[model samples]
Each structure stands twice: as structure tokens, then as C-alpha cells.
Target chain A: MAMAAFRREGRRFAPLLHPNSITAPRSSLIPQELDPEGVRFISTQVVRNRMKSVKNIQKITKAMKMVAASKLRGVQTKAENSRGLWQPFTALLGDTPSIDVKKNVLVTISSDKGLCGGINSTSVKMSKAIHKLNSGPDKETKYVIVGEKAKAQLVRDSKKDIELNITDLQKIPLNYTQAIFLTLELVLVDKSSQAGLISVLADDILKNVEYDALRVVFNKFHSVVSFMPTMSTVLSPEVVEKEAEAGGRLEGLDSYEIEGGETKSEVLQNLTEFQFSSVLFNAVLENACSEMGARMSAMDSSSRNAGEMLDRLTLTYNRTRQASITTELIEIISGASALEG
Target chain B: MASNAAAVPFWRAAGMTYITYSNICANLVRNCLKEPYRSEAINREKVHFSVAKWVDGKPQKPRDEELWHGNHA
Candidate 1:
């Protein structure tokens, strides 16, 4: 036959092909069969190992959730207390008209730690969207990222625009001093003409933060389970003055005199600076609270998912064990019948 | 641009020395301090420097000596 002739010819021409033949011992292409008992044993070991690891992970996530929950209480109280100052001040500036500016500074507040679902990314996404809307030929938008995790994400989109990225802040609870120092640094970076000309503190820097309005984007904590990224704007005193002249909330301010013989402009400037820092502080605290809430929810879900996976794996393991036992019983019965025959 | 109404720098406006500003901020934080956070704010953490120079659009490590002395005299 033609097939026989082809095989003979192939063998004669390629004698080294014997190693790939079916009769060859331990050929790498062939899969060695596993006995039911062996299969069951391996599966049990694998499932046990997997279950143990998952249980450990579940424990870790549960602990983390509890920690975040406890921390949330303290952070929430701090944020609520500061609302007394921020609510009325922002109400006063509510009607201020937007100003046109060449440069705008956007401060995105987030936390360095992740494992919280979308907490950091929400701020980064909002920052990116705002930058996209505002970036133009005549306009330049600079970003001040508060968290390292967010900095890493936003850096990809706007490396140059990331004027400052503060990390290692999550180790401690955010305080007023941190907020003031951070605001001062932001003011310094936004200044185009000044470079080491002089050392400035809170007041001089506030003047230099010359945006028609300052915008802080952060995750606003809604409840123990919900948080959303929110944008809050702080209008400059200059803009507020203009708004006042145009019959805004401060229309009656001209009739009143500032205490201590301070000029109206002086008093307004101080108030504006105070409000700016206060707003920034509140945002930082709220973001901290949100981060904790997000972490708690995320870890809770993670723990639940792990539990589900463990259940499925255990069911599969039990089925595999039962199958192995059934196979052994059938083998024993067959052997006894063969002996009787 | 140089009007009498120009905004005075805070350090000049308040005539605050470096030590005074730190002391003031410390005292202010300590005044309204509550339990657990009180000790953390006052003892554990300290805000040493006021000004951080932004070099090439990044905050440089706040040079302690230069910040206090360079701004003073």
C-alpha cells in the first residue's frame, strides 16, 4: 500500500524520529494519566491551601474595615465642626461672578493609600475633566495633587501641570498646620515672576494665588457607605469685591467699618485668606473621611467575595472526594466479579 | 501697581517673627484641641517651617535654617 511505502521511506530517511513515536517511553507530548485517588488527594491539598489563604485574606480585610470605621468617627466629627465656619462664608460668596484668568490652580485632595474602590481615581478623574474643560491656548491649568496615589494617576495625563504632589501625609491625621503649609506652597508655585525674591507666609501667598477663584476637588462623604467627588470654589477677594459692587451679599459692607482701623480692603483680604485655608482644611478632612468610608465598604465587599469563593471551592472539593470514593468502590466490585468469573 | 492699597504680606502685616508664627499656630491648634487628637497635635506632630520654596514647580525640602534666618535679616 502507498501508506506502508511512505512509512518505510520515512523511517529509512529519519531514524531519529523513534523518540517521538507512541511506543517511546516518557514522551513529553503524552499526558500521564492520574488515578482517581491521586487526583482527589491533589485537589484536596490545593483546595485546602486556597481556603486557608482566602480565610487569612478575609481576616485582614475585616480588620482593615473595622479600623477605617473607627477612624471615620473622628474624621466625621472634625469635618462637621468646621462646617460652622465654612457654611456662612461660602454662602456670602455664593453669587460671585466667575473671573477670566490666564492661569488656574486646581487642588485635588485624596489619600495616598488605595484598596478603597475609586476613592483616589474619582479625584483624579474630576481633576482631568476640569483640566480638559479649562485647558486652552490662552489658558493654563496647574494641578496640586495632595495624595501620592492620585499623583501617580494624574501624572500620566499632565506631568507638567502637576505643580506639587504631597505624599506621606496619610500616616497622621490631617491638621490645620498641614493645610496652612500646603496652601502657602501652592501660592508660591503659582507665582510666575517671583522666585526666591523673598520669603512669604499666609498673607502674601494668598495675594499671589491670584486665580479669579480657587477650586478644590475632593471626595465628599455622604454616608458610611456613599461618597462622591465634589468641586468647591473659593472666590478671590477681588472677585468678591466686584460681586459686592454688582449687588451681591456684601452690598451693605461699604456702610460698615472694619474693627481696629483696618481698611475695608485689608479686612476683606484677611477674611478671604482665612476662608481659603478653612475651605482647604475642611476638604482635606472630608477627603480623609471619604477615604475611610470607601476603604471600609471596599474591604467589606472583598471579605464577602472571599467567602463566596471559599464556598464554591469547598463544594467542588467535596464533589471531587465523593467521585474518588465512588470510583474506588466500582473498581473493587469489578475485581471481585472478575475473580468469581 | 504700587498703590497704597497693596496687600501687605502677612509676616509684615502682623510683624511676626518665625518663632512667633510657629508659636501662634501651635497655640491656636492646642487651644481648641480635644481628647486623643490634643496630644497628637501638640506633642507628636510639629509644623516647624512656614514657607516652602517651589523650585521648578515642585516644593523643595523646606530648608530649616534658610527659612527662619533668610526671611528675618
Candidate 2:
């Protein structure tokens, strides 16, 4: 009966002072080498410190989620509006498949930073798949990685295959070379700096470029929660002309007449170059949108988890404090009764 | 089957390569885009990363000279 009464009060049975192991992410916020005996000795103090760290993490996660949400709206709008730019190119050239090609240049587009989700992985996976499907006897392949993340992932196994890794392009175009930027503004859109950047990069690419066809791999944003890695193929003007004669996969361009004095080959060459830049523009915007979306959702979940952890820690803190107080009261009562006896 | 012979593009006549011409075209299209998106598009493309080309399985050193003293070559 005496044991049952102690158990009922949970004074001896209460393991509240014993810290329970938390989930991975939350535990990482607290120090790993927590001494159990020390924790019991300092009871509520340890829980207070842990709660403080979790509260800070929760604040950061909440802030990140908000930032991503705001950025997504702008990027998502641009991505939607830019689809018209590449649609006509796909219709004209016809998306070149991976099964057949002579020499291929794969432009793998990825974000410079990570922590979004599996977006960069998906892009790298698609690029590898394309590389695998296209590599065989009589076929040649090379890589033109755009962002740092893609380069890091691809450099592991296919370092030898990488021809160019273009990064920090924004600074190179506007401030680095005014001559080219002025030329682009004079000929094309004077205010569109993105075009100037593209042209400048293209100039750099042309210096060390030789490929029969080019394939662009990037993430295509579908919704706030869903994204897909997409690959679009573009053939060189020379190949298109050659295939046009043979009535091969690229026969669609023949139906359209070259209105300018420039010959069909010249016009085709210009069109292919324009198509590449336009597609690149769209690809970058879509990837940016997807990154923001992924980050928003990732941060959202993180904050939610932090909230749950805070609740649990608060409960443990209250229960431990109450148990200690009850034990103190029991001690005083026992002492008083012994003195009376 | 050609009706009217349009003049050759100015960029072509100026000895500019197809790469420049294409950039010009993309910029033109970018300008034609409706408001907000145009600015957003322009803003999104401006990404600054400290990186270099990977040639022969090796990374080219970033331009240390250019990054210092705000000097661009």
C-alpha cells in the first residue's frame, strides 16, 4: 500500500528529470554531449537553455520561409511570362531527342546555392541520363555547366567531360566589358541587361566551342510544391540544314521561308543562336522560381517541426518543476510527523 | 517563293558574330515583355558567383586581380 501511494504521486516513478532524446534536427540545436547526471542535477535549467536555442531556430526558419515566399511570387510571375519566348523555338526546331546525335554539348543549368530540396540533384540526374543515353560509339559528348552546384556534382565522375563552367556571369557582362554591352543595347533592347549578359557569355563560349547539337537541362516549375527537371534539345544550323535535305527529324524548318536577303543558312544560324539565348533566359528564370518554391516549403516544414519541439520541451519543463516541488513537500511532511511521534 | 527582300540585320553588317546578334535578339524580346516581369526578369538574371571554368578536369582560378580594387579587365 505504501509503494502504491508513492507511485500514485509519481514522486519516485517520475522520470521527468531524465532528458529524453529528441529528433535529429531539434537535437542538433542543443549540445550533443549533455551529461545525464548533470542534467538531473540542474533539471529545469537545461530545458530552459534548450528552449532558448529552439526558439532562435524557429525564428530563423520562420524568417527564411517568409523571404522565400516573397521571392517566389516575383520569380513565378517571370517564369510564366517567359514561356512564350521558348515555345516558338521548340515548335520550329523540334525538340531533338537523346537517342541520336553526332557531337553533343549539354548545358546543365543549376542554382549556385543549395538547401532548396532535390532540385539540383534532379537537374544533375537528368544531365547524366542524357549523357548516358547519347554516349556510344560514333557519338561524342561534352558538358557546359552553368552554376556551381551542378559543377560540383558533375565534376565527381565526369570531370574530364566538362568543357566550360560559367559562373558569376552577371558581373562579367555589365561592368567587365562595356564595349559588348553597348553593342547589344544599340542593336537589341537597350535596357535589357540580361541580353547583354547572355551575348557576352555567348562570346566567351564561342571562343572555345565546337558541337553538332546543344541540349539544355533545367528545372521547370509547375506549382508552389511541384517541380520537374526538363531537357530541351537544339541542333546546330549546319546540322539542321543537312538534316533538312535528308528529310530527317529537322524537316520542320523547311516550311518557313527566310524573308530577309540573308540566305536560309545564315538566317538559320542566327535563329539557332537567338533560340539558345531565349531558352537559356527561360531556363534560368524557371530554375530560380523552383528554387524559391522549394526553399519556401522546406523552411515551412522546418518551422513547423520547431514549433512541435518547443511545445514538447515546455511540457517536460513544467512536469519536472512540479515533481521537484511535490518531493520537497513530501520531505517536510515526513519530518513534521516524525517530530510529533 | 520570296515576296519582299528585307535588308540584312545591322549587327551582321557591323561584323558582329552570330552570338552577339542573338544576344541582341534576346534582349529585344526581353524589352518587349510587359512591366514588372521585365524588371523581374532582368533582376533574376543578375547572379554574382565567384567561379571559374573547368578545363581538362581542373578548375581555372578565379580572377583575383579583377575582384580586388574594383578593377575590371
Candidate 3:
């Protein structure tokens, strides 16, 4: 078969980011390059240099893998805790599965760090698909890129659609404050289409950049090797209130007494914002965790491949070194024999 | 249900968005909680660093503004 054996093996054994790497590796030159004809001693030096470089690359990837693993451990707990915060709100809002959501902002959470395997691409791909599905003559879908990776990719195709893009989030550790600001930043971009207002802008489309709901696209961390791209829909409080009046799903909210100085609508809005912060917090944490997980796996494999390449190069170097030494010995012995004759 | 007595929330009447209302509520909730439990919750959840408004390709300097301003701080 014309296909490389590793292609089938990579598919069966490791269906991962290296699907592209399978096309052709440098080791394919082993047979042709090692051919004795026109072989020079300098070839040995070249192989040694490659072997040294591969060793260095392996060391870097191994260190990066360790870093990603530690980051994943640190972020996992926060993501879990934040998940609990949003559950109460979802119960209040009553997640009506079949409700058609139109005119919503798609907040895609992604890291610009290309080291994280295919996570950014996966999220961007899903966002594009959702945009295609939602955007039409009647409906509208605008993008609010939470991280720069999606912005970079989406800008190529959906330049006019991107309303806001925030970056520099993934390079540092994320906590509750960063997560909440990430949400609030959307509200701050007010009068002049500024960079500040996630909350205010979310109020309405006519005034600022407004939408009925927010479809948050992020990667949900499952484990070290598995992450699922997910979309969580958050509807505006007004929409939820309207739907509650018609659909009897929220009859339970009436049982509890909201005994604050503020009116019930004020309380509801507060709860909505509070609840959304939790969801946004959870999303950012989960996305970060998954990014680290993907990076860990990606770096681990890169390390392994580097090791394999080094081994092959070492073998070739030894063979070439020995071959050149033999050629020198043959030349000396034959010259002595010719002089004696 | 008191459908006849239904009144719009005061924050809405004041033209405040949910974000403002939530900030006010967070401040109030931190005030209502008792000691040890409150400290335990706040201390563990405290995030000290400030956030910079990311513009263009860089974060705006002098990011002195804290995203949250509540008793929890």
C-alpha cells in the first residue's frame, strides 16, 4: 500500500492532533540517504546535529507537558465550584429545551496559544457552524470573542460580525475576579462602542450591542485526554420573565419570599446577573482546564515523537560513521599494496 | 397569586441594568452573613489581582479599578 504503516497505526492507536504529522516524517529518507554512493563524511556531522536538536526539542516539550498538567490540577476545582453556582439559576430560569433562540450574541471562549492541540479550532468551528445556522434575513448572530484565538480565526471569515474581542486571559492564572470582569467587559462598551460594558450593552440591540440571549461556546473539560465543546444558552431576564408568564414552568418561584427593600423585578435582575457571572466563571475555568489538558497531551506526544526521531537518527549516525571509517581504511591498505607492486 | 398587586422592581424604575443590581445585591449579601462562615467563604474566594481593559492588542495600563467592590473585599 502507498500509505505509511504509521498512518493506520496512528488512526487505530492514537486518534489525536498528529493526524497531520502522519503524512511524512523525516525518517522516510533513511533508505535513500544512507545509500553508499556519493556519501560524504559531513553527512555524519549533519545527523549528529539533527540528533542534538531533537533531544533539545524533546526536553522542552517534556517541561511544557509538566506545566500544563499542574495548571490543569489547579483549575479543575474552581470550575467544579462555579458549576454549582449556576445550577440554582438554571432551576429558576427553567431551561426549556425546545425554545427557539434567535438574535443572540455568541461568546466563544478560546485561547490563542496554538500549543493546546485542537481546542481553539474545535471551538471556532462549532461557533462558525452555529453562526451559519442562526444568521439569516430575519435572525441575527453577532460574535463576542472572549479569547483571542477565536477572534483570530473568526476575523478571517466573519470580520463584520465580531462585536468585541478580549485577549491576554490565558497567559495568566484565572480566578473569580477575572471571570466576572470577562462578563462585565461586554456590558461596558456603551455609547461609542467602547471596550467596557458587557452588562449595559447586553441591555438591548438598539442602544448598544444587544441581543435576546447569549450562547456561550466553550470547551467542557472531561479528563486529561477528552474534552467536549459545549454551548450554554443564557436568556435575558426580560425574556425569561415573559416566558414565565406564559409557560407555567416557573410557578415554583412564587413560593419563596424575596424580602429586600428592592422590588421583585430588581431582585430578579440581580439574581440573573449573579447567576450569569457564575456560569461565565464556570465556562472560563472549564475552558482553561481543557486547554491545559489538551496542551499536556499535545506536549506529551511531541516529546514521544522527538524521542523516536532521536533513536532513528542515532542509528543512522552510527551506520554512517562506521561506513566512512571503513572507506578510509580500504583506501590506505589498497595504496600500500599498489606501492609494493 | 397577587396579580393585581404586581409592581415592577425598583431598580428597573431607576433604569439600572441587571449588572448594577447584582453588584448591589453582592454588597448586601456579604453584609448579611455572620463571621467565621463569612470569612471562610470570602477568604477562600478572594482574588486579589486587578483586571486591565484589553484594547487593540494590549491591556490598558494602570488597571487600578477592581471589578468587584463589596464588603467581601
TM-score of each: 0.74, 0.74, 0.73
**Clashing pairs in model 2?**
none
Q: Which regions of candidate 3 deviate over 4 angstroms?
A: A1-40, A96-98, A188-208, A248-264, A337-341, B1-73
Task: Give the whole-model CA lDDT for all candidates, comma-separated.
Answer: 0.65, 0.66, 0.67
lDDT of 2 by residue, A105-193 (tens): 89888877777888989999999999998898888898888777888999899999987676644343222122232222212322233
Question: Which CAPRI category fits model 3?
Answer: incorrect
Task: Select the stronger candidate by lDDT from 1 and 3.
Answer: 3
Sort all candidates by lDDT, best to worst. 3, 2, 1
The DockQ of each candidate is: 0.17, 0.27, 0.13
Interface RMSD of 2: 9.0
Q: Candidate 1: TM-score?
A: 0.74
**Distance from true position, residue A125, model 2, in Å?**
1.1
